[model samples]
Target chain A: MTNSIRAEWTKFRTVRGWVIGLLTAIPLTVLIGLLGPLGSSFDCAGPNGAQCRGNTPPIGPDGTPVFDTFYFVHRTLTGDGSVTARVGALRDAEPWAKAGLLLKEGTTSGSRYAAVLLTGGHGVRMQYDFTEDIAGPSPDEDRQWLRLTREGTTLTGETSSDGRRWSTVGTVRLDFGERVELGMFVSSPQHLETSNTFGGRLDRGAPTVATTSFDQVRTTGAAAEDWRGTAVGIDPAREHEVGFTDDGGDLTITGTGDIAPIPASAGSLGKTAENALVGAFAGLVAVLVVAALFATSEYRRGIIRTSFTANPRRGQLLAAKAVVVGGLSFVVGAVSSALALPLVERAELAEGFFQHPTTWLTELRLVLGTGLLFAVAAVLAVALGMFLRRGALTVTAVVVGVVLPYLLAVASVLPTGPAEVLVTVTPAAAFAIQQSVEEYPQVAASYTPADGYFPLSPTGGLVVLCGYAAVAVVLAAIATRRRDA
Target chain B: MSALHAEWTKAWTVPGTAWLLAGVVTLTPLLGVLAASSMAEGGDPARTSLLGVTLGQAAVVGLAVATVSGEYGTGMIRTTLTAVPRRLAVLRAKAFLVCMLTVAGGTAAVGASVAAGDALLPEGLSIAQGPVLRAAVGSVLYLALVGLLGVGVAALVRDAATAVGLVLGLLFLTPIVASLVSDPDWRERLLEWSPMTAGLAVQATVDLGSQPIGPWQGLGVLAAWASAALLAGAAALRLRDAS
Candidate 1:
């Protein structure tokens, strides 16, 4: 077995053109990754006629980009306190407008918090830590009572139609000190409108402000000082858009911006990590040519008969070939992807675009998953070469099967539904390995594959492509045994 | 003239040529049906119907590459070159034959695709319509130019698999990579420069202004790619020794 493997490796390295073809994948990936960012630039007018950089959304407790701007009217609370508010009317509300009572550690953005809120469309919801959401029962006639209580480190959110009776909306544990900011708050996310046209998706978003009138506001274990109103994460340019008016006990707070995780598709100025990996397709094509020719050229020259004479076991020879091809491709993919990510990010940064925050674990997964994707695709190409015993047909079949489906699904005139289905069913699903941004159910965004939100998780997508490669290898092995080489 | 006759005979004699042409015809409409049926509300039915051309172009590539590279594989090119002695004429003959067959297959395939669209999609697609007719004829021309491009690349690269891979990358990958650009002007420039994206722009019937490139102009860009590839192939044929 080792002999056959060594022979296969020797044969691959000996061919000048094939070696050059495989190596070309690395530079092609790096070059395209670097050049794609050069063409894209972003600029916005800042305060006092200065140029504004891209959005720098706060990083949440889970280390994801989050919108943390809202209006807060608060008083300091000691240990084990609760805030209750009657949401009388929410004016000029978007569907995701929030008029709620919140308990937070401080007035800082990205701080740990919990809230029970009345949403413009969803009635009542309890959201905590930017990423968690729980729906409560429907409100009657836009009127609801929201309450948040702190018991030790545990936070409980409850909602009621009347101020007297309350049902638990959600319970979550957030570690905080004895003193915290308990408040009445209002927030509305940017209104995003997406319309599908002939070729692509069109997205337009505008800042929205929602005003909530809160009466009968009460807090337990609270300080006696007057309630302070502040707008967290408000841009100075848009400061006038957020404010609170208090007339005796009735408080009206109007706020712009959201308090949820940034959706991968909208309401953020950052590009996903996969935007730098667009060169993968170019690299994959180069590796595919070499992988196909590695097997088919031997048949073209009638060298397979000589190979079989030495081995006498065709399956081992096929395995050896697969190992060599898969290993080379994996190395090329991993190295190129790892090198391209930072370089492309730097170039995009120079052009005023920021990368959405992702954990070190997800970044590692992307690098290794991309390597596995390329390895499997190359193995599939070699298997296809053995199965068909034709060079042009093998390369064409794999490219059309793999790359064409991806281009049609993500870049062409296909609609989102069909495009998602195309990626899910076809080998092109492997590209999902590069999806660095995740879909958040709490955020309303165009979560389509074209926007880098794949239907399948990263590992699930790699498994689908591996299934194709495995089946092809089995068929190729059977054909090799049955046919006279 | 004898080179043309000899090339014609050689083309008909190969069994794979017939199957490849059949693939061009059948696969085009088959995928066209899938694309047309998958479309949602408010799209150009004419363009969606012609989406099958994207798949059919693969078959066109196969036929054209096989026509050039198969001879090299079998060592038959040396024999033909000795007989004809004029290598350029032989290449011209091969190019002519490839284009002729691709047009025939492309026309039938595109007609079936449009007919299937008329049945599967909403109204506003017919052979009598001006833009639809232009799209239909332009698709046939597009397939022919793809064939010429394939023959040229195959002649230059000489290896069948490498040539197919190169041509397919040029046809499919450019538009995909182009779509990744976030700059509107850059994206438009990239689209205008891509052979498949520019040429396929002729399919649009509903919104002409929104298109990256105009119909005839897009086809002309593809024609430029084809001619340049042919010129390179001619240079390679003139410079290199026949194996």
Candidate 2:
């Protein structure tokens, strides 16, 4: 088996076109990655038409980009304090709109915070930081009493239908300074609407504001300063009006913008690390072509008969060929991906595009998974070539089955749901291996494949592609043994 | 004239040619049903109904590539060149035949896809409308042009798998890479020149102003690609020795 494999490798290396083709994939991947960021500029329009530079979103406690804009009505609390308010009504609210009491270390964007809020659609939720959410007792939308308390470093959230009986929703530990802001807040994220069109999708976002009326507001262990309204992280360019009116404790707040993890959706300025690897698809096409020709050319030249006679074991010969092609492709994918990641990220960063943070472990998976993706796809192509023995048909079947689905799904052509279904089911599922970001359920963002969010987990997607490759290899082996080479 | 006649006979003699032509017809509407059913009630009905052309074009490309590359694979090209020494005439004949067959299959496929769209979509299709009529006719022209492009590529490469791969990479990869560009100017420039994106713009019955290129101009871009490829193949055929 080793000898056969060595012989196959020698044959592959000897072919000038095959060697050149495999080499071509590396440069193609890197070139696309490097050039993808070119000609794209980021210039934010500051208030009064001034150019805003270095306006990247604030980083959360976990180092993720977060949406930290909301209307805060608060007063300083000395220590071990609690705030309670009855959310009387929520008007013109988007589904994910929030209205309730919050306790935070400061009024700064992305500061540590905890809240028990009544959502426009979901009844009540206890959320902390930017990524954590716990459901409250009721699913009711209006007239709910919400409370938050702090004892030393421990924070607790409770909800009540009336002012009399209460239920503890959830609890967590968060250390704050000697004084903290405790008050009522309101936020409504941008409203998103997707319309399906021929050959593409149209994603439209309009700014939406939520008005929440709070009454019977009470504070404990607080300073004597009067309540103040601050528009934390609000963008004046978006024409978001965030303010509050305190009519003798009958407070009303109207705000546009959310306090949650940033989503990879339409109308978002945040990009993922894998955005720089868009050129990987181009390299994949080049590699698959070379792999297809590697097997079909042997049959086209009648060299397979000589190979079968020399080996005497057709299955072993098939395995040897698979090893040679798959191994070469794996190296090509891994090396190119590793080289492309840093260069593309640097270029995009220079252009003022802030990439969502990713750990080194996730980056490592991305690089290796790309290599495995190329390896398995090459094996699948080689197997299909052997089984069909028609070069044109085999190339078409694999390319059409793999690349076309990805194009349709990620090119903004299909709607989000159907596009998600396409990536999940097709061999294109393997593209998920390139995703370097995670989706947070607490954030109501468009989780489409086009937005760098895939339906399947990275490992699961690779497994699906491997499943296809394995089936093709087994079938090819059976055909090779049964047929007269 | 004899070259045209001889090429037609050679093409029809192969059973694969008939099956591939049938694939163009069947696969076109089969995907149209899936695509049209997935669409929500807003965009151009004519364009949505004709989405099957994207997949069906693969069959057209396959049939076209086989017409030229199949002969080279079997060493039959030398025999044909001996019988008719004019190589350019042989290529022209093959290109003409591929276009004719693709146009016939494309028309049938587009008709069935439109019917499927009418049945599946909320906004029914009517061919009597100006844009709808243009989309139907332009789609058939688009398929023919793609077939011409495939034949030219196959002649230049002289290998079926490599040629199909190159042509498909050109057809499908451009728009995908283009969409990833964050710069709207570059994205529009890439789409304006892309064969598939530009050619398919002819199908848009609504939102014409928003398209990067107009219908006639987009088809012209594809025609430019097809002609350039054909001319390059002619040059290669004249320069290279026949194996």
lDDT values for all models: 0.87, 0.86
lDDT of 2 at A435: 88
User: What lDDT does candidate 2 reach at residue B27?
Assistant: 94
- The best candidate in terms of TM-score: 2
- Give per-model CA RMSD: 2.7, 2.4
Q: List the residue pairs that clash in candidate 1.
A: none
Name the candidate that leads on lDDT: 1
DockQ of each: 0.59, 0.63
Q: Please name the candidate that would achieve the greatest DockQ relative to the true structure.
A: 2
Query: Which DockQ-derived CAPRI band holds candidate 1?
Result: medium
lDDT of 1 by residue, B103-142 (tens): 9999999999999999988664688989999999999999
Residues B1-243, model 2: lDDT tens digits: 999999999999998799899999999999889878887677778877887888999999999999999999889999988988989998999999999999999999999998898899887888888999999999999999999999999999998888998899899988887777776777798899999999999999988998879999999999999999999988898789889
Cα lDDT tens digits, model 1, A265-376, are 5223577778788888889999998999998888988999999999999999999999999999999999989988888888977877656777878778878887999999
